[model samples]
Target: IRYSVVAGGFHEGEISCMDICIQRPIIATLSKEDSSIRVWNYDSGECELVKSYHSLQKEFQNTNQTYLQSVALHPSGFYMAVSFIDRVKVYHLMQNEIREYRSLDIKNCHSLKFSTGGQYLACID
Candidate 1:
């Protein structure tokens, strides 16, 4: 287990829940305090800082999130999903654009998975 102190770009506290790819190479992390998603290079242990929009926005406006959920990486390693209390935003990793994908508004969507080919997505409520 590699432990690193993560800071939520928007929120002041650090989150405790994070997920990493089983095959290694990439790491996805989520800490409730900040409600921000961080993508890192597992091999070099470098900070890639993929997305911090949610946190940035909250900090910019001085508002906070009601709930901080979990995050997951797609099997193909091309996409990532960040789940909050009731919403899941799918992101296309290569592009770094939140608008490129869809968001699933499900109650307690703490778990998300993509089929082998990454053609289908299933949410665990």
Candidate 2:
């Protein structure tokens, strides 16, 4: 079987990384070139949310040194963590919206993953 997602005009830059939620039919993609994250409902091939790092945090703007590295969706499908050059930001998913929940000051974080039980998040610097 093949799953085709209509993400033609959504991500302007090449997608750097992506992750699927274990508890939901959802997918999250990251575009390092544009510092953006897009959440999608894979079951219906719909784009649920599109948010740029620069828009969520001011420090991300006007700085070419910072770029998105990776993204991880929680097992419960209620949270997401995005890694950047200097830090990792966690967001809460609710009502088709994403809100910043917390952040970690980990430099050169290239990967992120949530535990199978959703009890912890691991970052590889």
Give the number of the best model, judged by lDDT: 2
Give the poorly placed runs of model 1, Cα more than 4 Å off: 1-14, 22-24, 53-65, 95-100
* Model 1 lDDT tens row, 1-125: 99875533333467555656655477777766555667777576565664554544464345444455677777766678777665778877773433337777677876676676667777777
Pairs that clash in candidate 1: 15-31, 15-32
Question: Per-residue lDDT tens digits of candidate 2, residues 11-95?
Answer: 8779889999988999999987777889988887788888786654456567655567899999988899988777889999886
Model 2 clashing residue pairs (backbone)? none
| Residue 67 accuracy (lDDT) in model 1 | 58
Ten contiguous residues with the weakest lDDT in model 1: 5-14
TM-score of 1: 0.65
For residue 56, what is the lDDT in candidate 1?
42
